[model samples]
Target: MIGTLDKAKLKERYDICIVGSGPSGMTLAAELAYSGLKIAMIESGSFKRSSLAEELKEVQSEKLPIKANSRERVVGGASSTWGGLSALLDPADLAHWPLSFDELLPYLKAAAKYHFPSLETFQNPSGTGWKFKNLADKLFVAVRPPFNFTSLVNIFNRKGVDLYTEATVAKLVSQNGRIKKVLCRSVDGQGFEVSAEIFILACGGIENSRLLLVSGLGNEYDQVGRYFMNHPKGYAGRLHLSKPLPVNNYYLPRVVGGRMVYAGLRLEEELQKEKGLLNACVQFEPDLGIFQKYAFAIWRRMPGFSTKVLTIFLPRTLRARWFADMEPRAENRVILSDKLDRFGSPLPKVVYDLSERDKATLEELFSQLRSGVERLELGKLTGTAADVLKVVKDDASHHLGGTRMGLSPQESVVNTECRVHSSENLYVVGGSVFPSAGCASPTMTMVALSIRLAEHVKSKLASKPRRTFKNQTSRTSSQKILIIGAGNRVRGDVLPVLESLPGFEITGIFARHASSLFGAHRSYDVRTMESLSVENLKGARFLYVSVPRETLAQVLSDLPGASSLEVIIDTPVLPAVKKYAHKFKRIHVAEDSVFLPWLDGLKGREVKEIECSQSVFRYHGMALVKAFGPINYGYRLGNKLYLKAGNTKVKIIEPRDYASGKLKIDGQEPDLTAIIAELIPEERGLLGEIKSTDTIVSKMGELKRVGLRRLLLAASRGEETWSLEEGLNDVRIDWLLHKVWIYLSI
Candidate 1:
C-alpha cells in the first residue's frame, strides 16, 4: 500500500485524500487507518531525497533566509533533519489557541506515546543560589530516531491507507463549496487526478499556503498567506561557574528508559506574562572548541587575568544559545514567486522581518538570565550584548501561520475545526493553522492536532446518511411558538426560520424596551413587558428562551404554562433552572456549542460511543439520561463522560478552547447535525438557522463609530475582538466563546 510510483498508479477515488507525507499527514493516516475509511497520502518525493524533488523547495526570501534544506521532499519530510525536540506549548503560550491546554493534552500525550515513549522526569533545579525572577527549568526533548513513512510502511500496508510517493499535487479543484478532485503530476511528466469525499492539505506551512493561493481555494478573507511567524534562534551569552554544580541529566543528553533524551530551560509563564515578553528557552553547551576560538581575543584584552581565569574555569564555562518566539505579522508572509519549478508550478517567496520588539525581548531575556546566574553564584556570565548579537542566526526551519485558525472566515483562513473557511470538505493541517508560534518545536503539536483531526474525519465519514439537506413541506397542524429574548437573534435568526416553517405560528415577542427589539418585523406582534405574566404565555405551545444567563432563572420562574408548554433553552444554562427543568411537559435545552448537532443526529442510529463538549456538564447527569434513555454511565478521572447503554459505549470530553468541536460515535464523527435537522421533528428545517455574518454586522454596527473602528483595527491586526454581545448573537463569537470559556470563567 506504500510505494513510490507514477500518479497513474493511484486509486480512482478514496474516502480521504491527504497531500504531503510529513508528520502531520502520517499521524492522521495512522489514526484513521482502521476507522473503515480508505486514505490516500501523496508525497512529492520517493523513499529517498533527490535533486529534482529538492528543487521544488527552493524559495525566495526578503530579510530572513529560507532554509531550502530544512524541508526534505522524501517520505519522512522534515524529520530527516529534525532535532526531535518535543514539548507541549506552555499554558501561557496557548492563550492564542482556540482550544484549552486540557483539551489538547490528551492528543499531546498520544503523540508523546509514539515519539517520546521514555519520558525523563522534568523538575526545576533547586539550591542553584539564583535569587532571580526567572530561572532555568527542565524541558523534555525526544532524541529517538526520526520517524519516517518507511518505518510505518508495513503498518499502513495492512490498514486501509495507501501512500503514493513521487506524486506532486499540482492544483486542488473545488466545486459547489467542496473539493472535487486533486490534479497531480509524477516526476516523469505523467499527470492524473485523485478524487475524495474529504481533502486535507497536510503539506508543510509554506506549501499549504502556496497551494491555496495558487488555486484560490481558502483566500476569501485575504488571509491565506498572512500572519506568518517562526522561531528565531541565536547565541545568548556565555557562563563561567565558580565551581562545578550538581547538574542532572535533564540538562544533558542521557539514556532514560532506554531512550536518549535531553532537557532545556524556559522562562516561567508567570514571569513572561508579567514582563509582557514572548516565550523563549535557552540551552547550554560545554564547548571547549568555542572557548579556544575566543581565548585569543580574551588574552589580548587582559593577558595574565585571562590565563588564570581560563585555567581555573575552562571546563565549567558553557556557551548559551536561546530560541525565542516571533510575533505573527501580516507583512511577514509567503507569496507566489514569479519563478516556477520543473512541474510549471510557481515557487514560494517568503518575506520575514524581525521587529524591534523581538530584539528587545531577546535583550531582556539574556539580561534577566545573566542577572539570575550571577546572583545565585551558580555561574558568572562573561559576554557583551554585541557578542550575543554577533552569533545570532536567522532560520530555525519552523515556518508557522499563513493558514491561521479562527471562528470566522473574515479573520482567518480556516475555522476552529481546521476546515478551510471557503471550502467545506477542504482541511489544512500542520503549523500553518497555528495562530502563534510558541518557543517549542512545532512537530509534536502538529502531530497532536493531526490526531484530533483524524478522529473528526472518521466521525464525519461514519455518519453519512444525515449529511444531505432536504426541503420539507409545511404541515397543517402547526404549533404556536413565542420567542422571549431582546437580542437580534430573535429578528435576524429565529424569526426568519419561524416564518419559513409551515405550521409554526409566531404568537408574540417580548422585550423590556421597543428599541431592544430593533430587528423585529413590523408585521409581528411585538410588545414591551416589564415582567413575564400569564397573558404572555396565553396560546403558545412552545417557548424558546434565548435570554442572558443571569436572567434565565427569573424567566423560568415566571413561566405561566410550565406544566403544558415545551421549553427549549439555550445552552450554558443556569444550574438552578436545570434542577427544575422536569416541571415542564417536555424540555429540551439547546447545546448550541458545535458538537451538539452530532449528538442530535445519532437519535435513531445504533451508536457505539458519543463524545460531546462538556459545556453542558451541569445538565449532563440528568439530560443525557433523559435524552438517551436508561444508560449506565460513570465519570472518568479526566472529566470524561463514560457511558454504556445496551451495545453502545460513549465517552464525552469538554474540550479546552483550541480543541475540535466534534462529536464521535464508535470513534467516528458523522454529519449528525445535518441528519438531526432532517430526521428530527423538533429540529426539522432549522439547521443553520442563524446567519452569523448578518448578526455580527448588526451587533457590531450597534457600537459607536470610534469603538467599531478600534475593533476593526484590532481584527485586521489578528487580535481578539472582544464584543459584549459575543454569545448573545449568532456571530462567530459564540464559537470563540465556547472555546475560551474555561479561561474566561476563571
Candidate 2:
C-alpha cells in the first residue's frame, strides 16, 4: 500500500527495493507487481513538493546553468512537469552501448504502448509531400496532456507493493560484493532501514552518480559518475524564405492523430556519418514583425479567424533553433562536493561542457542546413559558422551518461543488465545508465530500459521461492470504490483524494484508454468499459462516475442494472441522466464548490442581496452563496444572477480576476483552502443516516467526527498532517475554472 514513511508499517525485508519514483522506477514497479514478489518502492519526495525535497536538489555546476525546473524530486519525478515530447534512440547513438538497437526494439515498442496514446505515433508520417534532398524528418511525439505517475502510487500498493513517499535513501550498505540494505531518512528526519534481495537505483542522471559517489558502492575506479552529458541546444540563425515553403509547417508542433507531433528537420543519417557530425534536429519559428505578432495573437484568440488569411501577411523569415547530442567525455563529470546536504551526504559537483568536436558538429550541421535550403530553392540562411558556434550554448536539460552502463568495470558503473559491476544485487537505471545521449528526448528510452530491467529481474528471481513476510495487509481495509474513468479530472483530482482520505480503497479502474496505463495504473484491474458487470458492481460499495457530460447518459444507463451500488456523480447531472437517477436507492451529487474553504466565515452568516457577474454565475458562485444561508428569491439566466435573502450585499467575482480562493463580498476579500473540510462530518453524517447498518460507511462517519482531533493529535506527535484531499479539491476547482475559460472563449 502507498503511504508516507511515518504512517505505513515497514516490512523487515522485501524481494526488491527500488529507490526513486520517476517514470523509470514506476514502470519497473508496474511491470513487476504481478510477479508475487514483495517490493518496497522508496521515493525521496512526497506526492507534493516539500522544502526538504527542494533543499536536496542543490548542486555545484561548472558551465551548465542548471535551472530549478530541470529535475523534480516529487512522486512522478520529472514526468510531473515535462512536456512529454520523446522518441526512441537512434541505432548510431547506441553504437558503443552493450545493448544493441535490435535487442532494444521490442522494449521500445512496449514502452511506446505504455507512454504514447497509439503506436501509429511511432510510425511517423513520411515527409515526401515536403520535398527536400539533404534534410529528413526527425519525428517527436508528445504525450498529450502529459501523464503523471501519481495516480499509480495507490495502485502499486494495492498490488502488494509497499510504496513509501518522502523517504530519502541516505546510504547503501554493502557486504561480500552485494548491497545489503539502504539506510533512509524520512522528510521529518526519522531514520529507517530497508533490506532487500535486489536494490535498483533509478534516481535520474545527476543524483544517481551523487548517491553512488557518496555511498562508495559502485565507483570501482572512480568511474561511477563519469562521462556526464546533456544535449546542447540554442538558436543557430535565421532563414529568409524566397516564398513560404510547405516544409515550414513541418517545423512547428502540430496535433496529428490525437498527439502533438513535431517533424523537425535533421541532417540525413548518411550525410551525418559522412561528415562525422553529431546527431542534431533543427526547429523553425516564424519571425513575425511587431504588427504581425499582434495579428497572430489575435488570430489565435479568435477561433473564427482563418489562419490562411493571417499567414499571407506574416514574415517569410524564420528563426532556426538546433539541438545536438554531445559526446560523452570523462572531463565532463559529476564528482562529490566538499559540502554536504542536510542529510550529511556529499553534494554533487557537476563539471560539464562541450568539446571542440561538439562545436565543430554544430557548425557543420548549420552549414549543411544552409546548403539544403539552397538546393531545395526554398530559402537563404543568413549567418556564419561562427554565429552558430557562439549561440549554441544552452543545455536542453536531458541529463545522461553518468553512472553509464558497459561491459567493463573500469570504464563504466553498470553492466549490460544495468547491475553494478562491483555488486551483483545493486543496479542502476534511467538516463544515468545511458552510455551515450541520443538526439531524441531521453524519457521514452529510460522507460524502455526500465521495462527491460524488470524483465531481467523477473527471470533471475523466478526460481527463488516467494519470501515469507509479516503484516501482509494492504494499505487500508476500507470500503472499495470503483472508478469509472481515467481522464484528466479523475487522475488529477479524484484519485488523489481517494488515495489520501482514510475510508476509501480503489478496487478497480475502468476506462476506454486503459492501453496507456502501462506506466502507472497497470497494477489495478484496468479494463475498457463497455458495460458494467453485476459481479464487479457488487464488489464496490460506491461507483464514482467521472466521465464527460455528453456521455453521462450512456454511462449511467448501465448503472441502473446494479441497483445496490450507491452512485457519486462528480459531473453535472444532465437531462439525459435524470431518468436513471430515480432508479438508484442512494445518489449523491458531489457539489464540490459548496464546500470551498473560503466561504467558512460566511458559513452561518445570513445573506440578503446576491449579485453574480455573467462570468461567475455558472460555476461554484451560486452554489457557494446558497450554502451560506437561506435564499428567499433568486433568478439566474445565461450567467447573470440576482438573489434576495436578508440584508447583506454579496457579489460573486469572476475567479480569474482574483487570486486562488479569493472572494469579494461587500468590498472585503477572503482567501481559503481545503474544500473537503466543511463538507466532511456533515456529508459523512448524511451518508450514515441512509446506511447505518453498513459497517464501512459507519466507520467513515466516525472518522469524520474525529478528523480534526486526529489531525491535531498527529501534529502534536510530529506526524504528517497533510490535507491532501483539500489540496486536490482545490486543483479540481482550478481545472473547472480552466474549462469555463475554454467554454467562454469558444
Question: Per-model C-alpha lDDT, please?
Answer: 0.63, 0.67
Q: Candidate 2 at residue 214, lDDT?
A: 80
Model 1 alpha-carbon drift over 4 Å, by segment = 4-8, 117-131, 136-138, 290-314, 464-746
What TM-score goes with each of the models?
Answer: 0.58, 0.73
Tell me the lDDT of model 2 at 26: 86
Please estimate how well model 2 matches the true structure, expressed as its whole-model Cα lDDT. 0.67
lDDT of 1 at 298: 55
Instruction: State the TM-score for model 2.
Output: 0.73
Question: Which runs in model 2 stand beyond 4 Å of their true positions?
Answer: 126-130, 156-159, 247-249, 288-315, 464-485, 492-569, 572-746
Angstrom error at residue 629, model 1: 75
- Which predicted model would earn the best TM-score? 2
For candidate 2, the C-alpha RMSD (Å) to the true structure equals 9.7
